[model samples]
Target: MLTIVNDFLWGQILIVALVGAGLLFTIGSGGVQFRYFGRMFSVLRRGFHHEQGHISSFQALVVSVAGRVGSGNIAGVAVAITLGGPGAVFWMWVIGLMGMATSFFECSLAQLFKRYQPDGTYRGGPAYYLTHGIGQRGLAIIYSVLLLVTFGLGFNAVQSYVVATSLQASFGVATWVTGLVMVLGLAVVIFGGIRRIAVVSELIVPLMALMYLCAALLVIGMNITAVPAVLGHIVQSAFGLEQAVGGGLGVVIMQGVKRGLFSNEAGLGSAPNVAAVAHVPHPVNQGIVQAFSVFIDTIIMCTCTAVIILLSDVYQPGASDVDGVVLTQTAMAGHLGSWGAGFVSVALVLFAFSSIMYNYYLGDNSLSFFSDENPLVANIFRVLVLALVFWGSLQDLSTVFGFAELTMGLLAVVNLFGLVWMYRIGVRLLRDYDGQLRSGKETPRLRTEDWTDLDIDERAWRD
Candidate 1:
């Protein structure tokens, strides 16, 4: 019964809504993700103009990328390949491309409706916009509660569990040992609050991502002769034309979309929570940055993992026992001998650890909605998240994953509906941003007066 419910939520309902909304945003924004792809790096290079003690646009991008580039990029991609075959990889690319638009609109909206905290930090997400932008407190509260469970407890546990299992598999380490180390590390970063989290993420995310990508490229370089054929297999298999596996087109697309969501988190409403933290002069600036993050997470990081697994001789589709992170570990080992498993174990630790901190920030930001400026609320939630991280390391995989999927599905539905309802605002913001650029402005800063009717925190946008 539980499995059926989760499948319905993730495989059926959420997929349609997620993809449909993404398409809608893509058409609505006139391909903002494509038109301004180059401008994203320019805006990032312009650097941060944040308030005292607040994070810059790049820091927020790093924090968001930290969350997006986690176990999902490694384990989740493996799962997609195992279930959906090489074709699944092609669909993953499609989702990544479309999701860029979804990410842009939602993140820009997050910035538009973000609330300023007393300590000069910013907090916002689907909940803030649902309440202030759509004027529905009930919907906002539900969104917050769902986010609290999905990221704070469920997703964090999943991260810890993946790291623990990978370590146990690769190095004969106990799950409890990994849990203890994870708890200690999580405490130091999460307790220091968002700025500390942002700082650490900025440092670790880039270094770790570069290291993992370099390793993947090394493997791919060695198998350069097989690259073109493997790429062809991915496309053919996606349409049920390849005969290696029997998941059919439906299963292929489902696995690709599901794993893609897990990796990039474009329309899921999670990334926007951190995207709202950046003190960019204009909301679309961070929107573009967040959109670029989707590219990095899915197109670059997840694709790297996909290539690693697909290029390996060890990959066996439809092998029920060899799936998930173990499959990825095996593939890496096939490429680099026994040391590959150890390398992946270390990579998972870094990937999952940064994600746990990023998850805490989302939960902490949600806590602000229910109990404004209340330290106790955030403190209690912090304890709960940490406790779950420890407990998840020891819990069964099915339980943790199922719980995560259920909550995340609900969170996506709520957030996607809000995005669809207020998508015009996204279009309007993009137009406003593009207008400034076309008028010869180098760096476009938003004026609160431009969006007079919206419930924007004027102080946030005021120059």
Candidate 2:
């Protein structure tokens, strides 16, 4: 039943909605993602500078990246290849490209409608935007609930299961032991609140991503001669020119879209929860940074995993036994010997741990939408999240992934509809930033007065 619903959602509904909204956002934003590609790096440099009590743009970005570059980059990529062939990788790239624009719009709107908290932080996401931007409190509640289920419960479980399985495969550790250890470690940071989550993600995300990329580079260099052929195979398989897998083009496209969205979460409404927390000069600046994160997550990190797997001789087109993180680990071990598996296990632990922290923060944020930051409610929510983490570690891969995908698909549907409905507001925010830039402002600050007609919290943008 779970698989049936996920297949329909990913195949029929989400594929069209995801692609269509991405294309629409791309056109509506006047190709902002491309036009400001270089500007993204510049903005990121400034991101290191932020108000003392608030989160830096860089910290927010890394937290969001932590959430994105998790099991999806490793296990999910392997699954895509196993089920849809090399052609799925091509479609993943396509979604990454299109998702950049969608990310820009959604993240910008998040910043635009973010609320200023008394604790000297900001809070917002699709829920805040749906309520404050469009006056849709009911829709906001629905989005918050979906977000809570998808990230807080669903994705965290998936992450825990991936990490637990990876450890078991590499170190021969019992899954239950790994689950207990993970639960204890997660409880430490999550209990410390969002600032601690930001600090941990900041320190871990860059280091882990860099190390993983270096390992992937070594593997690609070892198989440099075969690189061109592999690239050609992906393209050919994508178009059904090469029958590498029996599923054909539809399956190839579906797998890529699903895995790609899972990896980067560009338009899935997940990243915006952290994107709203950044103290940037303009909302679009954070949006640009978030857009670059999608690039990093998919184009850089996920491609590294895909290339590593495709380059390894262990990866057969239809290998059912070796799938998920095990496939990735086997491919790594084949490339660099036994120690390679250990390296992948360590990397996955870091990746999935940070993702769990990120997932917790998103869930906590959503809980606030209902409980208004009540300590009892927050603590109860945290306990539930930890319980799910433990439960997920004991579950099989199919169970965790299926549940996460279904809930994720539903979350995306609501957020995408809200994004499309509130498209003009996103555009206006972009134009405001663009106009300031054109006027030669070094860093364009959002003046809330310009948006007096909207329900924006002026305190968030106060000078």
Candidate 3:
């Protein structure tokens, strides 16, 4: 029943809504993502701005990236190629481009509606805005619960399962052992607090991404002559009128859009959880940074994974028996020998580890909305998370993935409503931010009084 529902949601509803929302926001924002694309780096260069309850913009970037760029980039891309064929890669790119806009709007709205905790930390997300901005407590509660289930629990299980599978395949280790090790490591970080998670993400996200990209570069360099042909093949397969290249056009579009959404999560409403926690002068700045995250995840890391697999002899389109992580591992090993598999196992550990932590923070943030004063709620959740890690490590790949898709699709549909409902505020915030940037100031700050109509926390932006 769950699988059937997810198939319809992902295939018919979400595929359309996801792409449509992204394109809609892209137009409504005056293509701010592209217009201010160069400025994204400038904001990032300004770096961490320490505040009482907020994280630095760069720290937010890494934490969000930790969630965005994960086992999905590696395993998910392989799944797209296997089920959807090479054409899926093209669709993934399309979604990534449009998703930049969706991410910007959602993150901007999150920041705009953010509230402060008594402990001085920040809190906000689709739930916060749905209640505060639109005055819909029921909708807010629904979104919070959906977020908790989808990312906090379901997605964490998927990450653990992916890494556990990779380690098992590469080193002949027991999955239970991997699960035990993962639980211990995760318990230490998640129990340490959100800042500790941010600190770990800051250090690990960049290092792991660079190492994997470098390895991919080596593989691509070795097959330099075939690079142009592979690009042409991807384009041709995507639009091929016939069954010349694997899964035809329909499968291509479906797999590409689905996996791309899973990997980049631009329209999925997950990034805003971390984005809203950033200490930025303006919400639009963090929006841009989060938008940039879409590019990094899909355009860079995912593309690398696709190239490595497609360039190697290990990948065969329409191979139903192919293991997603194993396909990627085989591709790497094809070029780097035995050490390649080892490297993939290690990379998956790092990528999935940071992702698990970020995923926990997202869930932890959602939990706060329900029980701001209940420490026991958080403690119970921690135990549940650890238990899921072990249980997921031992579960079958098909079941874990199916459950993840169902939860994530539902989460996306709920959050997309919040984005479309709050569209005006997002645009207004963007315009105000642009106006400040164009005013020739070294630093631009948002003034809450300018928009007294919206229910913004005035103290958050007060200088």
Candidate 4:
């Protein structure tokens, strides 16, 4: 079963889908992420502004980041290092740089195509962009179904399992206990819709990320001298030039690309769900914000984790394997002792909890993508998500984590296709946006092909 599952995940289709689409997006937009790297920080530091959409840009970014900066940054990186080797970190950096452009393109299209719903809110995503940009109803349906399957079931289950397992180990609690707490919390936030999700994410994601980053920083600072050797090992191992603490170059590259992309999810189409709700003059404004989000997730948050592990130097030249949250805990223990373990446990709880809540919202949107929402189906999916939490807790690492990663990769393929289909729209939007940037105009309306043709009077927008 594991072989079949792993094979199913590692097959040609997913590889082509993820790699091809990613490369295509990078080339399509002239490597926009690379060009815009330095500018991303200026955009974020400017903070949220008042616009005409449902939420502020920062809130939208926060909600999206809530999903991206997940346990994958911590445990996921460990998994990458375990399989792909130290050089995988370099691949991750490649993914982060390229994925930002993909993210920018897709999210810009989402904002461009979004519908102002009858309830004075917004609704859109890969489904909307695929339908609106490509005029492929069938494509939208297929993408929505895949997103629902992957986000609602596969990723949700993985997140719950991580939470439950960590809690059981740390606090000696029942797995079900953690699942229920997550389920109830998720239900409450999601029921309020995008606005509520935005507010909650903005408040919680920053607080949790800051606390965790601060702790990791202190540990890294204490052992700052080891940084050079650690980096040297990463470089040497990446080229197969030397044997560092990690294992395989191919696997590491794949792992870094995998986790880095997973962490920020720029091209994966997940962030656009929240992006569609933001009120901004130009779609690129949100795109800029999303780019900043990638920096925060990988360049800042994941780097902190990596640095701490390196600084601690917990792994001996020949020690039994320790990966995932355990590896992180082990590294921290080298510095803070038992307190390090406790810290990661607490971090996992918050990280997984925030992530699960965001995933639930994604599932909810995905459910709505079917046209009509069914209370029965929604409730059932929620229950299954919670049940999978227990299932994840009980399963062994190889089986459960591999299964989850496979599902995530598959689902990401679906989302990436939808985004890739909308590339033309993004280009045109950016063209107009670039014009405005050059002109320095106070009236910063986006460039549109046919402003009057917009679905402006969309129910709540009944002009």
**Per-candidate alpha-carbon RMSD to the true structure:** 1.3, 1.5, 1.6, 3.2
- Which of the predicted structures, 1 or 3, would earn the higher TM-score when compared with the native? 1
Candidate 1 lDDT, 167-222, residue by residue in tens: 88878999999999999888888888999998899889999999999999999999
Best by lDDT: 2
Q: Over 4 Å off in model 2, which ranges?
A: 397-401
lDDT values, one for every candidate: 0.88, 0.89, 0.86, 0.72
For all predicted structures, in order, the TM-scores are 0.97, 0.97, 0.96, 0.88
Encode model 2's per-residue lDDT on 1-463: one tens digit a residue: 8888888998889889999998998899898889999999988888888788888999999999998888788888999999899999999999998899999999999999999998889999999999998899998898888888888888888788878887887789999999999999999999999888998899999999999999998998999999899888889889988766777788888889888987888778999999999898789998999999999998898888888888888788777764677888889999999989899999999999999999999999999999987999999989999998999899976776678678788889989989999999988888998899899998898887788999989889886
Candidate 2 scores a C-alpha RMSD against the true structure in Å of 1.5
Q: Whose lDDT is higher: candidate 3's or candidate 4's?
A: 3
Better of 1 and 4 by TM-score: 1
> Whose TM-score is greatest here?
1
TM-score: the better of candidates 3 and 4 = 3
Which 10-residue window in model 2 sums to the lowest lDDT? Answer: 314-323
In model 3, the worst 10-residue window by lDDT is: 240-249
Model 2 residue 346 distance off true place after TM-score fit, in angstroms: 1.2
Candidate 3, 342-455: lDDT as tens digits? 998899999989988988988888899999847899999999999988888988767767776787787888889888988888888888887877888766778887878888
Give the backbone clash total of model 1: 1
Distance from true location, Cα of 270 in model 1, Å: 0.6
lDDT of 3 at 376: 93
